[model samples]
Target: MTARRSTFTALVTLLTFAGILVAPQASAASLVEVTAFGDNPGGMRMHVYVPDSRPASPAMVVAMHGCGGSGPGFYSGSEFASLADRHGFIVIYPSAQQEAGFGKCFDTWSDAAKRRGGGSDPVSIVSMVTYAQQRYGGDPGRVFATGSSSGGMMTNEMLALYPDVFKAGAAFMGVPFGCFANAADYPPGASRCTGNGGANRTPQQWGDLVRQAYPGYTGTRPRMQLWHGTADTLVPYSLLREEIEQWTDVFGLSQTPTSTDTPRAGWNRSRYGDEVEAYSIQGAGHSLPSSGMAAAALEFFGITGTPDPDPPVPGTCSVKPTVNAWNNGLTASLAITNNGTATINMWSLAFTLASGQTITSGWNATYAPSTGQVTARNAGYNGTIPPGRSVDIGFQATHTGNAAAPSSFVLNSTACSTG
Candidate 1:
């Protein structure tokens, strides 16, 4: 390990042993796992992070990851840990079912998952927040959810389904309001124009539905952060602009931003009274770079603006990326550090592997190989990583074709470019 990682490891070990005795002195941050109630027996696991002294300190952001993502990766790479510590707030990430093969993906268009209170979907997420409030002390006044791609689509669904619960939503690379209908109408792969099913709605129609969804909320239209990359290929870029115009038309937002600034990356930010904001990153692609956009979300959470100098990358989660030729497998261990400003209550990790490797695991968890990827389950380490602290995970794998250890790494939830 590098000097910095070693130091972080030592500090995290100390804090883990300290438990709740120290109380974090300043704004405390830790990751905890809570069970979200649904109709099913294995409900769903949610990773939560909160400040030391809560109730009214800072708000919370329900950070949702994209397709095949895990709560732990979101907590680690998004820079939420450091941001929570600095701004004195909380961040929560909930896992989606892997029955679809990918780890944490929302079945946004599933007919069975969308029935009124029938599916183990939206209700499950709301149950998670309620659990946080009851056990971890979450603020009801200011609660929100932000997501990327599929996760972002879920954010829109949350706004539509649980309008009374969430204060606002931040969507990045997500489809517009009624985009789900496209998938549902086509039953599989339906482009925007093709899906004219009864479920589908135009952008304006979605805005109208959202307006009616929240009847009593006479307050300023719920705060929101809209983000998109001009180069986003998965979710059409034009949809973002259209969503912004439609949302503003329905909500009556100011024509321009309250404050405009560029903290990092090529992202141009537009803020509105700490309630609403948007970022249009220039030349960016797909998901937010875990470091930049995640930190941006933290700032939007009203956390302090001290950026993590060396935030953990997705690649840093494991250590000693190695391949076992004898067993025809590849393996590595990972360390998760809390580089954000708050505490993480719980976390889970998920990643896809290139073809040729089938994971047979050895660590704190087991490996389930499917669709050219490995899903490892690690539990019971609810250790708190103070700002800039690190935690580690170890794994060993078996290879099929020409499998080799990963050349890249992630530490404490952030993504590293190289081994």
Candidate 2:
């Protein structure tokens, strides 16, 4: 009886601790619906959150939702409403329409949606900003925009199409403006988005894309903040590099990062002067990080009194590859290791496939093959690689004659030796 009681007590204690680990944090603000209060040009539903202590002319933020996510969900998930409550700001969550095949995603990839001064989605979002400033006593000059995933892509579109409207914008897990020329090019997963690495375009070439988004615009461009999970398989982590390069060129900042901050073990910030800041959240997946990203964005826009905490020492990670099995010029298995001090949230592996070999199917990653080059991004579950841990991913390929392993392998953009 004594042994049984001790085991039961230990089990109860462990379960309690587990519950604490997974419990959701309480939200600081409540969401309120404002029906038909603004011009519904794009026919979007508005869910606004206004703090009780909102001062006169409070700053307004237009928050957008990702594909298949509603405004309320975004409000709850991003904790934007909570931040608004604390900071005395107004937050507008614009819900998207269910387009024919794309579900609830803003048409940011289309030319019509990217245009300025029209009744399209971009213009409609700007109208929301205008409405917030007019009816909600929002500061027009201090208005900002932010979103995640597809919404993040829309955020980029807004900044480029209406540079004068937004003082600053942040995009999490998004692509650059005009990355896809049209709807047909819009792949089901953004991991396949074009211009992932700027397509080797020069700074001028990339800047020209943004310039063309708004014709004859010479206003001061809005500042930009980009955040990406290092382990995001849905959107390749390499795309973050392209986004920074494109924006830095548009802002005419040097290519090198002006400042690098590791706010904690798994967070990193690379500032390109004051106009552009890119955050790489180590061990984070496709979701918004809980480590004060919303607060940091508010501070960057100067809308909130809270300042970002100084980053701590950055974490390091190393990658190793091992061939698990190769069969009859047809099947193969590979394993990778994270041999570093911190957890890896997102990762990309690149290698040269043996000549005449073609990948047919892969698991635990988004596989892309191009003329002797192959790149695989982390799938949702396999991205988090803890320190001194390992994960296995496998692929099937067809080879003409020889099925030898390639001579080189790179992980997270760093070269690695095969184990």
Candidate 3:
């Protein structure tokens, strides 16, 4: 709900290397702090994560933190980082310094923050996006935004002000752009403006405000995906409708939903053409991003992952493999034993996957060439194996048919005894 991940205590351990431009730490994990990315009028901090195994020109997402939340905190809390790891995309987590009653927050209410290139939090955010594009060679057309609560409000703001910059956005429990006006009244009047006052405005008026942010801008407006709980009291649930109103109008689409259905049992979803989609979670007040929401959001962004196979298959496998099979997916774990007389350092286990199996992601060890003849290498921390010791590696993959173990295995070029 409120401060969804703001209470994470181990953010420092997760973030450690701030103000340093280092290489990707592991196969699929690295969070680096970039100081001079670009103009940062909002005085926000930038933390970027680029998975070791990713596309050459990866898609990018700006993940803003809620009030009282830090970039590293949200990175640890939200599933976007893991999804980024799976899809090989870049994530820009910006820490907001401005206070929004609860804690640190992106400037959603400020006049400067609301307008396009008006020079505030939104400007700082765009600077981060630009830096990601320039530094990481990110795909410009696939840039996106998603955040929770106040950060979610910034998500809406980014889409509204810089439609050219983002292809789409997902706002979890957020308000409409420009709805947080009346800075003099602040949080006291926040309820009034977002609740009774702002919710009453016609859809046209709300849409006009977004249009005015970047006046005369004639480009494809980024699509929107909004999530809100029915019983939210902090930022009333009614603003969900208000956000739908604003974006629908901005896209010149009808307010009447084109389709409505339950994405999950208690979660109702309404789609307005392809421009906007809103999810209302029943009885879930202010609480957001409930489990698989991040995955759904990334799917909406068209960042589908791939196994993209490794190489040609080889001989008999030499590892003890245990598998958990499901309908179309399976999880496999393989234990490799080092029975050599001497201690071995820096191990690479190579195995040929079964036919029709494609890996999505793996842990403990880094797997390359996700399918076919693949190689699993130890991470930075697990590079050594004493004699008579074993190291376990695992992967999750999608299978069209049989979920079998690797046909052959080779550990650092020496074929071991078959299991």
Number of clashes found in candidate 2: 7
Per-residue CA lDDT of model 3 for 172-282, tens digit only, reads 988888876555434634455665655578889999999999999998999899999776777788889899999999889999999998855457989999889999976
Regions more than 4 Å wrong, model 1: 1-30, 36-42, 51-58, 98-104, 111-119, 182-190, 193-203, 212-220, 254-265, 270-276, 305-419
TM-score of each: 0.58, 0.66, 0.67
Model 3 residue-pair collision total: 6
The residue-level lDDT of candidate 3 at 30 comes to 73
- Our model 1 lands, by Cα RMSD against the true structure, at 12.2
Model 2 per-residue lDDT tens digits across residues 1-419 = 89997996787789777874322111236676655454566777777777878789899898988888878878756657767877889998888873726568887766678778755688667776776777767898898999988888888889988898999999988888877767766655442464345345566777888898888998899999999988676667777877887899899999899889886445698999989999997655566534357778888888876554732212543334444335545555666776667555546666788888777887876666533777666664465667777777767777777777654666654566566
Give the whole-model CA lDDT for all candidates, comma-separated.
0.58, 0.73, 0.79
Superposed model 2: Cα runs more than 4 Å off: 1-29, 37-39, 98-102, 189-200, 306-419
lDDT of 3 at 297: 83
Candidate 1 lowest-lDDT run of ten: 20-29
Better of 1 and 2 by TM-score: 2
Residue range 251-303, candidate 1, lDDT tens digits: 65655656898755356777755665678766544645333566656555444
Give RMSD to native, each candidate: 12.2, 12.0, 15.2
Evaluated with lDDT, which candidate comes out highest? 3
